[model samples]
Target: MDPPLSFTVPQEDFLLFHQVDRDLYKILVTELSRDPSESMRLLAMWLWLEKVGFHNVVKNIMSLPIILINEIADETMLCLTCLTNNSNTSLTTIMLSSEANDIPLLQSVMENEISLKFFRQNCMEAIHGVEKTRKEVCMRAFGDIMQRAMMRNIAERMVENNNFLFGSTGPINLQFGSVGIAGALGQQHSNNNGGRGGIIPADERTLFVTFSKGYRVEEWEVREFFTMAYGDCIETLFMQETQPNEQPLFGRIIFHKVSTIDMILKGASKVKFSINRKHVWVRKFVPKRTNTDKVILPGETSGFGFGITS
Candidate 1:
């Protein structure tokens, strides 16, 4: 029986065999075997070898069994022809057109995580003989493959935070009241409870405002003014009315950042700024006790210091 083919071909050369002809095949094989560790460096060397006259090196390398040589050479030639004809073909088309045994090798090249320099230097060099537009299309295909590989790697590393709301420190023990009967009664007697465990505390970023007498607070006007003053940091702004058929006596403003509350309070007091030309007092909101009486009597204030009657 003929001696088995002694040399194991590099994966890249196997994928790009069509690009190698008899005149340049020897140089291509030599370059691919230069440094076993650097795949991309070897690829660059293969692309640099120009097609010249036949040499003794080519004869020696082709001394392998006729059957094996013809198999690889034929596959390479067919792949090269397909690529040269359809330079702008998709990667899938390139892979599908290749011989069945070579499919895995072609897939490996398409999925290889090489740098942009590899595509620009080696990949572009392989298609140097093609038209400029066709060359660009080929480079773009290679670039798309690299980009997809990078995105997939990034996505794999990104672990979803299951406890994002509570945070990674673990679930917080938010106690409604202390443990025992006293705690239960304390919670029950607390007017802020509203028949629940405890009153929902006001967000630190929110501000409670009491408008000056004879000033009718408009929700849109307040929102527009605060939005202009604070830019996008003002998340929410709305007027609060306690009595029916009456104008809004107060308003609430919630900021995107809690740190901005102190800054705004200090600045508002210093400037003596008012919303809609009326004196407006602003302070951090404090959760209030729930009242049984739904309606605010004409002259009574709702403990927030804002009177219904001017």
Candidate 2:
């Protein structure tokens, strides 16, 4: 006995299927319409979905028409690339580009599952372009902020210790020598002193630290080390040459404020710290008023300049 079999979907079930499809379309449009900040949150959700092996859901979202895909920014595209589990496909490059408008490529990606090597190459180029644009924007914004902040005299003084302004914790190399904006400002302030080369006022505000005898150190390393110890209080540091024929072997650290110097000196008259296992001695730098002023060290009968070994 043979009986004809008939299958029919209930009317209510058919209506429910259409409702779900429409809801999904609305959700996708809403997600694409979000701002960049909100898009980042959505990206995190998409990444989680991908990690959980929700491939179909990811495919559906990514394969949206070109008009919908173009609404997303390049940053969002980069985020999407991080979740591509398929070695054969670069969904980011395929779906998030001007080439998405190409009918043949779009059809191949959507239907035939095209796997092109150039997709990865183009994706990398787009990512790099986005990064370069962001970096330039940040630098320009920072320069503008500094210009406004430095308009006031006090703020300009603050800029001396703010490494963000000069790009690092050391002196900027000028044609004359390695010097900082603080040193330049000090030189300008002391213009009234006349003829004698600009000398920074020596008090508790400055320290003359001698490195281990015969131990060589780079200028940047000294700046970085001291900056870590003193933070923004350590405005500038430079090597001092005690003898004309000898290489500069000592570092002079200048504090941004006299108060910081007083605080450090009160804790210790002389400090002993080590850099790379080599001993360093730190003492307040007291500048001599006259050329004849001299210092005598233990076991040495003749007087010499403050930092001179002999």
Candidate 3:
């Protein structure tokens, strides 16, 4: 066992391309078994690099120093190949630029195609392997890679898909249970069902539902519509219209307003309602105990996924 490197190396380049320099790899492997102190220290540094979009920052740390070097060589070759293929179009542009402003043209057209591919390939592998991570240490490293990968993939796909729905839709949409029922009507309803057992109060129930096409609902008729839908008044129904919020559950929902109906009627076809707000938080009177048995947790339901509220 050898001593570990004293200082941490920033892996911005390696993170994007998992290309650990030869000297760096040697240090990681030598420190891995010799002394856990140095190994852990360097490991922390490596993990930080991974989180910040440095893919395969530990590429040099393998079964052995020699094997590590061999893997780097293999990866370098693969990356070079990917770069070479990608460069063909740029190379053609370069050749055409001889009669034009070659400097600017070259700068704009040429990039390290091989390095980019190598980084993407290795980084994606590490990211996808996140499911195998058991420890928090490993999880952080994998998380960084995955975040970068997803961002890149989504950005690239957006460009490729050419989904330019600008101004055509608002960034967010808002919805809420109808508040048309006055306090008097609400009290009357409660009085009528006062002592009825199992009759949930009108204000204590909320429905997680979508609005009709062409509108973002602000005030709904509790007595006529939602009362029947929820079967009672409830506080706080996590309603998601358009698409469900995926993380950090319990936030306002934002959507666009595609259109509005003075009176929503049935038989609306292919109606488009643009999102008006990104998130809308609506408060309601929910019963003491909400039902979780019917609400499936994420990963438990086939397509519904999990929900803390559920």
Candidate 4:
């Protein structure tokens, strides 16, 4: 298996817009005294629309003013918070909202195994008439691939430790095809602990929080994540969650793009071993505690991508 490539986005942008959406929903509905059961049902269905393979339903009913029904900021935040905070149920809500709007975010899932490429490709076909929508969908698909790779990487690490509790073998055992990032992670709840605390030391304890068996690392694109930089750097394919300080608490990637196969061939290129090279093709990062800021040294990356010999 090859390494996964990830994309980094400004965390503030996502959290901020989500807040606005939450406020909007709260203000519109709280005053109308709408049917509580009806509103709950709508919210549930909306989540399924994005997280589950129910995009058709979402496309059909998304036009409804579910949020506009309540206009109170507090109310909106409450609803949004509920969906965002509760992983088991709320993951669908987060996925739905993000998918409906952000094409890049949606694309991150394409790298995961849960969904066949057909759905995204169909979306491209359907939206080809609209240039703007087409571009958006394409970007979303790309982002989904990146995110899926990251999720799979994290899941693989956890599965090795038998850290996840929801599934005895592993969360990847269950197949809930087409669930978005949050939904996938949510389904694979850990028995030991929840949140990002269960990630391996190499991953800096930040959990991908998704369940999928997409961690095949030998592919070219997957190799790109490791070759682009030799130190801690953000991925271009998926967004990582941040702490309150907005610093990434999880592992960062360093990539170096290898143009000539010779660069890879001449280097010591064995997995799990280190070789000294002026340059290397790929390296699985291992963070050291020496620096206040985590940075994988050039020598370290060269050491890891150390298997290929001339």
Candidate 5:
């Protein structure tokens, strides 16, 4: 089949939104492929919707919000249709250079698995419509995508730290604990450990806590339950916020004395608690150290396993 060119969005935009796009693409490939799960169709669409919304905002196109949503939503449906029917239509070809291949993101995916390909009579078909309810759905979808990308908190902080960004109150979190602090210090978890502690250091007194695989235990439930066993020895209790329904997220319990951790660990990596029909666990808290803040030197790879050929 003769390859057709698609220029609905600029080529550079794909590389610009690479992380979110790539993530969305991976999900789409799985969901839109043969044997697609009818159960997961809604989830796949939400992920796709958020990706498109993020692009709309960053590019400052500000088209009617509904337009972008319908455009992307349609593309999603079209791709699903293409895969399901298994039509004999020639697989879409994107030349990187041909005048070459197609859009970088689309072209790159086609280079991978065969069943994940999509065909559009024209690229513009994928983008050009809006529904009556526009901005609200758009915002929620985009915000959720940011959460999936783990960039929502940083965006929230950027909003709060700047007077230019806030409206009357601040943006409301969609998730229950979306904006709530899952981790904080002492009687009032209003503060963090405040960098590394000076004297004993936070880790010496902190015990890492993990729950069972089935349920998501809340931060408060963890604190109240553990306080019974460890007593007032608890200095602070904190848990990381993640999916409220799926994998059990972990937490930290800092005791007043270092000996508490010794008693809990007892020369093992972790200690378990089976109380009130739920199993909880405790270990030593070791803060993750990352150089993500540091800039890559001129010749360094970006850690994507590929060198900067540029």
Candidate 6:
């Protein structure tokens, strides 16, 4: 193993396409391995890059050495290719002009968790195969990546918690709980049932279900509806409607097991339950991107073989 670089790394073009950059790869492995939340770190770093639009900043190489580097072989552009061979996403962009509102990155790529995870895993693997380092900045950058990642995780969790509606009136949503009972009703129901017996609460055990083109769905029927159609695959602990007692079509459900939702959906985004000649859909809620036509680059729909759904 080469000794860690004590001083600043020179602005040398090391990341070249069709070539392995050993030092950079090692840095990715050591830092990512040392940190338990490596996945989050990778996610946060990429999200930040996406927010700022990486291609725009790469014109100034040192601007984002962690992502795009102005390395030797490609003098005209910075290197953004994934280190590992599996990734189809090219880190760099073609004809990247400084002035542009559009990110040009495939929205589908960003939205699909699997694609992003695969890309990050590839980068880490190529990095794992590497031996050691040649730059102080690279080490510092790695630390920064973890810091931002951890912070992002904290922020995401904090935001999802039901603190905001603690003292105020709010609509019941997946973030809240099961059945049309939101604040006081849910507690009352649990008390009436002698507490949530044999029920477990986990973040992974929650699923957002929506009913479309169906009769006004009632919160009371959610459990039975899923049970009859899905064959009681798992015990449903509770349900809370997004709109309480207004015949709301969507709600959040709590299952006894974390895998219950997946087992029911069977890899599909939605399950169309035929109820009274109506269509009821339950899916993993993916927030819709507004003004998608402007954000997603044109003529870039070819790389969406990863089953990315809206």
Listed in order, each prediction's TM-score against the native is 0.28, 0.28, 0.17, 0.16, 0.31, 0.27
How does model 3 score by TM-score?
0.17
Model 6: what TM-score?
Answer: 0.27
Task: Look at candidate 6 and give me any clashing residue pairs.
Answer: 13-71, 13-72, 80-91, 178-239, 178-240, 179-239, 179-240, 179-241
lDDT values for all models = 0.39, 0.41, 0.30, 0.29, 0.39, 0.36
Per-residue CA lDDT of model 2 for 14-90, tens digit only, reads 43533433333333323222233333333333333333343443355454432223222232343445434335354
What's the distance in Å from true for residue 210, model 5? 1.4
Q: Tell me, what's the RMSD of every candidate?
A: 29.0, 25.6, 22.4, 23.1, 19.9, 17.3
Task: Please report the candidate that would top TM-score against the real structure.
Answer: 5
Point out the worst 10-residue segment of candidate 6 by lDDT: 70-79
Q: Model 5: residues >4 Å from true position, as ranges?
A: 1-198, 242-248, 292-310
* Comparison by TM-score, 3 against 6, better one: 6
Model 1 misplacement above 4 A? 1-202, 242-245, 267-272, 289-310
What's the lDDT for residue 102 in model 4? 22
Model 4 lDDT tens row, 1-310: 2122122434455335334333322322332333332333334323333443444333322222331122112222333343334454543343344222122212222233222122233333322222332232222322333344446546555664563455453333322222333342222233322232322122221211111112212223333433462322222222223224532111223222221222333443212212222111122322222211233322232122211111
As for lDDT, the candidate ahead, 4 or 6, is 6
> Could you tell me the C-alpha RMSD of candidate 1 in Å?
29.0
Q: 19, model 5: CA deviation in Å?
A: 9.8
Model 5 Cα lDDT, one tens digit per residue, 243-303: 4354433555666667667766789765667656666666675432112222222122222
**Which of the predicted structures, 1 or 3, would earn the higher TM-score when compared with the native?**
1
Candidate 1, residue 270: how far the Cα is off, in Å:
9.8
